[model samples]
Target: MDKIVQFVQKSEHNATAVAIFGAIGVAVVALKALSFLKVLVDVFLRSGINLKKYGAGRGGWA
Candidate 1:
């Protein structure tokens, strides 16, 4: 992390550009984490309609 900070500080890139790119990267990672959490909650905590009640294995559409 120190190396990264040094590189960014020493590079010729504009500060605003670096800040914008960093913010975009952070937003992407955060959104991905939130999406994964949502999937986990849906899979483990949420309940779905009972397919058996709709005759799922009897050839009728569930």
Candidate 2:
């Protein structure tokens, strides 16, 4: 496709910009993956969570 060709032939500045944006995108995706794994592990592993023992989250509404 024409767009692919243009992307392949991008100027140095554009290429650098693309690389930086791509790195940022990768980091965001990795963070999301890590968060999902954390939630999955908590769902399967965290047991007998006594919020009652912790008490009503500093109750007494303002």
Candidate 3:
């Protein structure tokens, strides 16, 4: 645990390491967002109906 903390502190003191870490963090977040979008697309495709058309239909609890 101490070694991990020391490594983090050392990295924080370096500008290049900080920039690399920031870029890696951004990439991870972007990948997760893209995965969520893919799942949503798959769900939409399986439902076989357009969201706009479904929303316009009369149904309970509108």
Candidate 4:
């Protein structure tokens, strides 16, 4: 246990930096995924889109 503690003490700075940046990266990815899921639910599912009329008017993108 003492050897493990000593090793951790030795690498404290590098460990702290890695942990902080890793947490930030994880938070950013989570926020992006949440944003994408919100758009999927709000725009794709909740909004009513008349596909046939839209495709007929807009020329073959159905």
lDDT of each: 0.87, 0.82, 0.77, 0.81
The regions of model 3 sitting more than 4 angstroms off are 1-13, 46-62
Candidate scoring better on lDDT of 2 and 3: 2
Sorted on TM-score, best first, the list reads: 1, 2, 4, 3
Model 4: which ten-residue window has the lowest total lDDT?
53-62
Candidate 3 lDDT:
0.77
Per-residue alpha-carbon lDDT of candidate 3 for residues 1-62, written as tens digits (9 for 90 to 100) = 87756676785566567678899999999999999999998988666656556565556245
The clash count of every prediction, one per candidate, is 0, 0, 0, 0
lDDT of 3 at 46: 62
Model 1 per-residue lDDT tens digits across residues 1-62: 88777877886675567889989999999999999999999999999888888788888863
Candidate 1 clashes: the total is 0
Distance from true location, Cα of 1 in model 3, Å: 24
TM-score of each: 0.67, 0.67, 0.52, 0.57
Which candidate has the top score in lDDT? Answer: 1
Ranking by lDDT: 1, 2, 4, 3
- For candidate 4, write residues 31-62 as lDDT tens digits: 99999999899987896767676666666764
After superposition, the stretches of candidate 1 with alpha carbons farther than 4 Å from their true spots are 1-13, 57-62
Candidate 2: lDDT of 34? Answer: 100
